[model samples]
Target: MVQTVQSADGTTIAYEQAGSGAPLVIVGGALNNRQSAAALVPPLAGDFTVITYDRRGRGDSTDTPPYAVDREIEDLRALADAAGGPVHLYGHSSGAILCLEAAAAGVSVRKIAVYEPPYFTHHVRDEPWEVFANKVKTLADTGHGDQAVEAFMRHAGVRFDERVKQEPWWPAVVALAPTLHYDLTLEADGVVPEERFGSITAPVLALYGDASPDWAVASAAAVATSVKDGHQGVIPGHGHDVPPEALVPFLIGFFHE
Candidate 1:
């Protein structure tokens, strides 16, 4: 069944519950809602009461302007609390950053699986990110959601002619470009605070694709090193877009252990 919860800041966060065992929350990558992880949930439902939610300003969730990463973390915490206590958490891409931050903030995450958070070091420049953020905000403000989405794809290293043309969610992501800038801004300002990963006491499992960018691999390793009981793994034959089926078994085994 689907359920809705009003965050402390009045945004309506929507979530779906399935399966029948220990509660587990799945947070999707940037520009994706709960449905993005659909493939993994059904199989997992057999052994877990999986919870999937629309991050703020997407899907059925309401958008509150002046977005803060803390607000997003709170939404996750609210869902976790509702699920009982100390539930397992999993997040992909930016969602990984959120899950890590939530765990560090004393959210009672029993175990966490993070998939390729894009935390770059000083070697990486923020100029491109800033430029992209501005362009996206302008496009979204000017009613050019399509263009904004295109801008986002370019920033995320998604090829122009391939996935964008064939994937069904491409257009939908473009339609929600207005929220894309907020997502970018949250990450740029270090809202997730990469330096604070050491504070997370929960056992963390960090996953990265063998074909992912060098910076992504480095970031995942850095996070794994910071956590007290963190482990890192590489998904073979996958890039940043790791397949759900490929990851489900890993997650089930880790969380169940």
Candidate 2:
């Protein structure tokens, strides 16, 4: 069912709630909306009241002026309250970064299960991200929205099938590409502040794909140390866009444990 909740800053956050049992909020990474998570939902929904939503400025959610990371955390807190409080957070890509950030910022969380947050320690450089962000911003500012999406995806190293260029969802990516700034800003040079990560006290299950970049394992392992009870999981044949089957066992074991 479609529902709305007022974020701490009064922005209206929209979400779709399905299935039953414990509440689990699925936070998608860049360019992801509820539709992008449809395949994983059925499996998780069997054991959870799975909630998938559009982050602000994407899909059905509203955006507030003067964006800040704190505001997004407030958005998640609002959804958790709406979902009966202290909900589980299942985050993908940069959404996992937001999940960790939210828990560190003191949002009520029961558990966090994240897949391949883009936190890099060794295999990435700091300078290119700034350059990339500028190019994307310029294209978006000059109204080349579709080009902006392509540029962002390319810079992020996503190899989409050529068929996607002709799909109906291509337009959605074009529309949401501007939010890349929000996602990139959350990375903060691909490393969060020590105190900030040190504050994550929740039990975290961090996952990474074997087929992802060489830094994926290193990044995941580093993030595991940030949380009090964090652990790492591996998917043998997946990348940043992990196959749902590769993640099923981890989700079931962690959430049901």
Candidate 1 local Cα displacement, residue 46, angstroms: 1.6
Tens digit of lDDT per residue, candidate 1, span 98-179?
Answer: 8888888788789999998877663355466678678889999999888887767777777877546568866787766787
> Against the true structure, what is each candidate's TM-score?
0.91, 0.94
Predicted candidate 2 versus true structure: per-residue lDDT over 1-257, tens digit per residue: 77888898888888998899999999888888778898888989889999988888887788997778999999999998888878899998889999999999888898999988887767556457788777777888788988888877776787856677799878878888778878887866777456777877778998999899977787788888877788999988888878888787798899888
In terms of TM-score, the best-performing candidate is 2
lDDT of 2 at 101: 91
